[model samples]
Target: MAQNVKRRERDTAAAQVIAETFPPNVIDTLLAEAKETGTPIDGVDGLLNQMTKAVLERALRAEMTDHLGYESGDPSGNGSGNSRNGTSVKTVSTRNGPVDIEVPRDRNSTFEPMIVPKRARRIGNLDDTILSLYSRGMTTRDIEAHLREVYGVQASRELISNVTDVVVDEIKTWQSRPLDEVYPIMYVDGIRLRVKDNGVVSTKVAYLAIGVDTDGRKHALGCWIQDSEGAKFWQKVLADLRNRGVRDVLIVCCDGLTGLPDAVTAVFPDSIVQTCVVHVIRNAMRFVSYGDRKAVVKAMKDIYTAPTLEAAELGLAAFDTAFGARYPGAVDVWRHAWAEFIPFLDFPPELRKIVYTTNAIESINFQLRKITKNRGHFPDKDAAMKLLYLGLRNISSQRGGESGTGTHGWKVALNSLVNLFPGRLSF
Candidate 1:
């Protein structure tokens, strides 16, 4: 009964408190001012920050009054142990940019301001604002310039780098985390980033593995920057994936790289390697002569686009007779890669469309390029890796389903995979 009476008293006093705090013309005055200026009254360079400063200052004064048990300018404070000191000037960064405000202080340093606490350099949301920009591929230099021009804040390059460096710990944690046991298809590819290694600056390759689990959701397995591209390094990459908990992979799709098929088999011996036929066609077309290019491209499609491998072989032999004499190097390239190429032919058409090309990985590489294009070269391998990881994180945040789990095209691919491999997949 006592709790009920107290709750009723609080609910009834709420309106009385609001009436005492706000004037009837306050909203009207705001609307009239907005009409006269033709500019926004709330967001970005508006009266919002000024009003916020006024409210915070007022609250600080109230806190001081309560602390002293007397009102401002009252003689009652003479008996109190501590007295009011002059306000201190402090600037804090926020999502709305920077705001300079006066903070109240006490003579004995006993009063700890709560509105803008002591030693609080920035508002909580400001860090997230900086991180959002960094994830969208804005370089630290660009972020510094943006903060200055738009938010009226002078953020040093080091300050901006410091904000992004927080992610390095999260990245380390994510890389070693456990993965799904089985992935129906995995796309492996490398994107180039210019990095300084050991004293010399050169273009280095960063390897990425994108796995599509049974639920049709795509998981970015991991990304790593290697000193050089070699079979030994690739083997280590595969070993790392195995260590993370990838027990079975049905097919690994990749562009033509020397000895990569063997590398896949070395890691998951039962995993089928599907060399991108689209890459083969494009590379072969490069070797064909100009006048013959059109005729050669149409004929080349006949070999891989055929419904059956038997017919594809007949088309392959005809292609050899038709243009193999002139483009013998191209012919040899196809013949050498044929062992890896036929794996796609063995699968049904639904499955073939996926494993026959590295389109999945290529799309991801395109997204990474959007972020790295402005950078000429990173300071080191870790620097390059950080930028790429942020780019991937941003893309996932922007397009994943519900809680940002599955990508857009991945659902369609998973639906097809479900029909093709009914028993081997699990969400």
Candidate 2:
């Protein structure tokens, strides 16, 4: 009898301890202690799971009540209660965790979220990771490994491709968006890429036009892919520019592209087309011997660095006299391109500094090449366009400022133009 009484007392003590340890206040205290100690509680993962489930359930219930005009939980005490349409919720497994999301019901049933709307499934931090990788020029396989190692989540190439495909429509819209009326200066250039065409690989040219508006902000006008670039195709491009709202371009800087000057003249009658002096020099040097290149370059510099058109002409005469026999082709190129080169000289020195070269477009192309460094070659025109568009989009946000010495010179030159053509120039 004595032993039995002792055992009952021991059982009572154990029951009291269990009741005290699991009280609401005790659980709160334990949670605070775990937080302070930076430790996970034993067997608390299940508790966390339950808590998350309950929170999600409550949220879904509220959404259904608000949107479907139906109350959740128990009905009125009467056997029959107000009837309403019921909505179904689905559980979606995601990289972060599992979530219960409500499905939308509409008459059309074709609503697709472009930017990932709320209550979406199979979407989480993975999308952000993929986009970040893409911006940094990571390929699909690289992104797959990165996610596998960082989040212990395996992502397939098709999934990554689909995620990136969301930007295609956006790129199309941006390509067709209306441009500003008057760009103070416009830079035109082409970048070449190897793409598969008709089941055979070939080289294709991608033309890009970048413009700086009157307000000093840079804008990417658009991009086009073609088998080649020439006057006729470029005329179409110019007409497209007009249709897209580019009314006036005061100056256009470009390389020695065939028929380009005529095309520009046809579109913007008042615009001055300046052939890039740097391209002229590069073309000139090709005709000179390696041993005489240094001397030839020195002579070329005199032609560009001359203070006035007459000075430049004198320099050119001297250059032809010195190197004509050795590099007749080089001198002829200069003479042939001189009409385009001399337009900048008609403007003030400040204006000449900006329009004398196509360096602005070249700088942007350099960044583009960096983005395409690892791409051996594109499979098709669409693939090449996609990569270039992504790079442009990433760089587009940084469009608020002038980039180089040329830009500084442009500011001064534009101010002078504004004073000279007050009615024509608008900021």
Candidate 3:
């Protein structure tokens, strides 16, 4: 009798294991067999569901708490060291899956989570999805549809806007943050945006500043909106940068904004200003005939691509002799901007590439344009500024490093600046 009872208990345990492992159909079959034998298969679905949830919760909690350096019920507690507010755990429903998170509480109640915090009951993964989509140049409607189809979660346009807007304040603070005392190379440029004011939409300039540090890391200094580019506005921007701790900029690459070189000289008297060769060429090309564009561009290239300053001067003289009658204006622009244009000629080939153009800032403006492509026009200057600033922050945060080319050139240029300035510049 004891042998028979033990065998029956073993058989029952085996059946329970099978029910848990197999699909719903298999479990139903096992339940039917139990019913026929006047036995019960109770709480199987609920138990299995609870067990799965517990396992997932444990894994997620472990991941979240790993770097926190605290455990449950410790007297000193969670590295925060406040005992009055015990740790509160909250369950958030996310699109990827549900997660159990520990909410850190404090006496001041001012600890706002920069990553993911309590009261953010929606899925944390959704923010990542939106950011990813935004980076890939997706429109708001497209992002909304993607979230709906991929995650089976309904996210509204307004919600998406609000989520992206969270970066605005952060961007503001970053813009005003202290910068390194010396930047080897600084690139400045502007992109045009349509902004509405008093019910009229007009073009506004979005100015950008990109700095290359001593270690070859590229940093975006800040962005601002202005009616137009001029010496005065640029002086203000430079002053703000100086206030933010930029003691010296070695070489400033810019387009031909009149008096801009003077502005840089005024702010950082020792800094060299180089006009963008690309911009100068493009501006020159605009005055040439379409039929002669190819030849004209070739001549212009010779002027910038020459191996030395003397060779470049020879190339420019040849270009003037060749096209002076057909496009005298183009030749005159080169002559006028020659001072700014020729500064790059004084540098080594490695340094010339870094200081010859404002491509770094232009690349950043391209990204800004992509982010604002879908918007018809901003309502005001503030709206335009906010969007541009946030877009820049989003880009810088994702790319994680300087967004520029010619690192070797930047390093060489920086060394030259250090030699020229002696002790005034610091990294």
lDDT leader: 1
Model 3 local distance difference test score: 0.72
Model 1, 73-113: lDDT tens digits are: 88978868788888988887765556777887788988887
* Pairs of colliding residues, candidate 1: none
Write one digit per residue (lDDT tens) for candidate 3, span 155-230: 7888887776766666677778888898877888888888987888988888888888777777778887888878
Lowest-lDDT window of 10 residues in candidate 1?
401-410
Top model number, TM-score: 1
Off by over 4 Å in 2: 1-58, 61-121, 287-294, 399-406, 419-422
lDDT of 2: 0.72
Indicate the residue-level lDDT of 114 in model 1: 74
lDDT of each: 0.77, 0.72, 0.72
Candidate 2: residue 305 Cα off by (Å): 1.8
Model 3 misplaced stretches (Cα beyond 4 Å): 1-93, 97-121, 305-314, 402-406, 409-411, 419-424
Ranking by lDDT: 1, 2, 3
lDDT tens per residue, model 2, 1-427: 1222454588698669767857989678868876787655432233343344554555555554554344545454224333334445765434444445444432333333332344554543457567657756788888888776654556788988888787788778877888888988889998888888888888888888888777555667889888887889889999999999989988788997787898998988888888898899999888988999889999988988887999999999999999998789999999999999987676777777777777788877877778767777777888788878877765653443223122565567778778755677765
